[model samples]
Target: MSQAAGGVGKRIAKGSMWLSAARLVVNLSGMVSTVLLARLLVPADFGLVAIAATLMQIVTSITEMSLSQALIRLDDPTDQDFHSAWTLSMLRGVTIAVVLSASAPLVAHIYGDQRLVPIMIVLGCGAALSGLANPWLAVFQRKLVFWQEFVLSTASKMTNVIVAVAVAWYFQSYWAIVAGIVGMYAATVIASYCILPRLPRFSLASWRTLLSFSVWTSASQLVNALNWRADQLLVGKIATPTVLGYYNVGFNLANLATRETTLPLIQTLFPAFAAIKHDKPRLAAAYIRADRLLVALGVPVGVGFALVAQPMVPLFLNPKWLPAVPIIQAFAVIFGLQGIAGLVTPLGMAMGQVRLLFMRDLQVLCIRLPLMIAGAVIWGVPGLVAARVLTGLYQIAIAMLLAKRLAGVSLMRQLRTHLPTLISCCAMALAVWWVAGTGWRLFAGYDLAQDLVLRVMVGGIVYIGARVILWIVMGRPEGLEREAANMVGKLRRRPA
Candidate 1:
């Protein structure tokens, strides 16, 4: 490996470590908020909010221009670039807010839920606040200074949870959720400005440069969001708010597996990839290394979640949410497939191949959107999830093919590299399933929560032990063991 490649690898590893810590806190806090709101607010409340939230997502995506991404990709972005991006972002936010507010009644009518009107308005304002967030935050991302992002992001999530819990406890309505979102965005925007403390000029001087990059990036983002969220969008229209709420919970829970594991990796890689885009060898190496780590971590998390869902649902959630158990299990598998596929977009952007990313997303949308609609209409909730699982598999195939073409790494090599992790995860899944399935049979006296905790502990141990032993057996396949030893060596060499 070149010195540059080694440096980038270490930076990514260190950055991911920091980001993982931050996202762990963020996810935990989010879970707390989800649990509190689930218990306090009814499923219908979540459903109503889901309706408005979906509309807001659609609006946000439609107006999304990824100027932060552009800034990161540019080798030497000037102040004018930042000013231009910020100005465009502000306009996008205001435009989305106005459009959402004006369309609130129509959106409510479409969903046959008038409660969405006010929620849409509130969420719209929140979206606008998000737009005004200082673009200088990308400066840290561009340089792989992720710890600051960790601080800012975690603070934002903590603020969201505190305000959300208090409002949900007091008001006991969907407004609590809406208000919490507003607070979270407000906090994030404030933190961004504090980080840089630079006022952006309201100018269009750099519009051409910014738009040249962002046009395709924004299109891909819009299509990608639509592709993934089409089920929720369609389900909200056909199903009751309560049903949509259940689906939302299930979907989010499933996402916990993939998103929590891969999110930091993805965020860390975009800038890293862009830095070495001209160096094909280094870029490909970084891409493969990242892929291996994601599969190693993500597959087990998704499988474990599926294995424990039966016990987890009853223990952590109220009985009213029982319907989401199967949905969560199915989506878990889907997200596992997506854990690797999610790399396609960022990789393309980093390679200055945004048009290819758009084409890939457009391909998925052409197939997946129709399937989602059919599934929602024909089989209802289960069908919706099943359709997504199918799409997930499709995305995997498409994304890997694209990876081979863009990165010059064959699909067979990619699959072979992940094979050990796949085998280990499968073994771990079986072990977890057996434990969760028959734990009560073997140890008949524990309460549901105790049983769940025991199963999780056993599952985690089995998974880790199996992964380590299998890797050693495979001759330390993927170099994970080597990486661990290297980390230990570095730590020991440091002053105690």
Candidate 2:
């Protein structure tokens, strides 16, 4: 690698480390909050919040101008640019809040649950507050200096968990969840200024420059949000709060394992990709390396979590959440497969292909919305899950094709890059399944916890063993394995 490439790699590694540490803290606190809230409040509490949150997301997506992305893409943004981005962002937030607040009664009527009106109104306020966050935060990301991001995210999430759990324990009402949502955004806005200490003026002097790049991005965001959240919205209307709660909890838990694992890296990849976008070969190489590492790490966690969902749900969340086990299992596996093309979005954005991305999202939404509606109408939640799994696979194919077009990486090469991790994950899944099925007979006193532990251990062992053997057989290929070795060597050689 050239010195320039190596420098980019170092920046990515350091940035990823900081962001990963933040995610680790956030996810752990989030899990604790989830468990505590699940016990203190019923599924209906979760269901009510989920419905309101989903609606807020849809409305927000519609108005999202991708100001941060626009700012990041600029080679050198001026004070005017930051002020314009902030002005637009604040306006978008207010728009979302007004739309959501005005639609609250209608949403409540559609769901036949009057409780959602207040929830939606409150969440809309939170959305508006989020707009006040420092627009200059994007500069840290653009420069690949993520420590501030780490502090901002961790502080906000910690505040959310602390406030939510305390409220749940005391109030024993769904208001606890609402309070947490508002608190998180408030913390975010406050932390953003505290960290950067910037006084952004309200101006649109650079509106044309910002909006020019964000037009297609906004379209893509709207479509992508609808594609992802339509099912939940539909479910909230068609099913009872309790049912929606189960589905919501299951879906979140399933995504938690995979999303939290890859999100830090994905966040870093945007700026990293942008740094090398002018050099197609370097950009492509970066994408491939990032995607491979993501798959290798994400696939095992997703699949392994699916394998253990049956025991995990009961052990961690109690029997009331058992119905969520299958949902968790199904979505976990689907998310795992989707990670194969996880870096495609960053690649496209880095390459200035927002129009292509918008088209891709529009196509998926066209196909996904119909299938999801049909599935929800026919078979309820299970049918919806099945439809999502199908669409998720389709999305993966579309993403891979997009990667090829944008980066000039072939479809064949993309598949081959993921083959080793895919195979290792498959082997691990099979081993765990077998151990949980017939192999349990060997232990005289096998329990749910024991089975879960045994499966995890076996899966970890089989996956590492298989991955190592494959790496060796492939002549120590220059990929995640090599990266791991290099990282280890660096750590060992560091001065004490």
Off by over 4 Å in 2: 439-446, 485-496
TM-score of each: 0.95, 0.96
TM-score of 2: 0.96
lDDT of 2: 0.89
Task: List, residue by residue over 235-351, the lDDT tens digit for candidate 1.
Answer: 778888888889988888888766677788888888887887788886788788778878777787887788778777767778889898898889887787677776777788888
lDDT of 2 by residue, 1-496 (tens): 5887788788889999999999899878888888888889988888889999988888888998999999999888999999999999999889989999999999888888889898999999999999999999998888888999889889899999989999999999999999998999999999999999989999999999999999999989999889878888988878988888899988888788887788899999988887778888877777787888898878888999999998888887888989888989999988878888688888889878899989999999899889988998999888889999999999999999888888878998888899899999999989998888875643677477787888889999999999989999999989878888899999999999
Give the top-scoring candidate (TM-score).
2
Cα RMSDs, all models: 2.1, 2.0
Question: Among all windows of ten consecutive residues in candidate 2, which has the lowest summed lDDT?
Answer: 438-447
449 Cα displacement, candidate 1 (Å)? 2.0
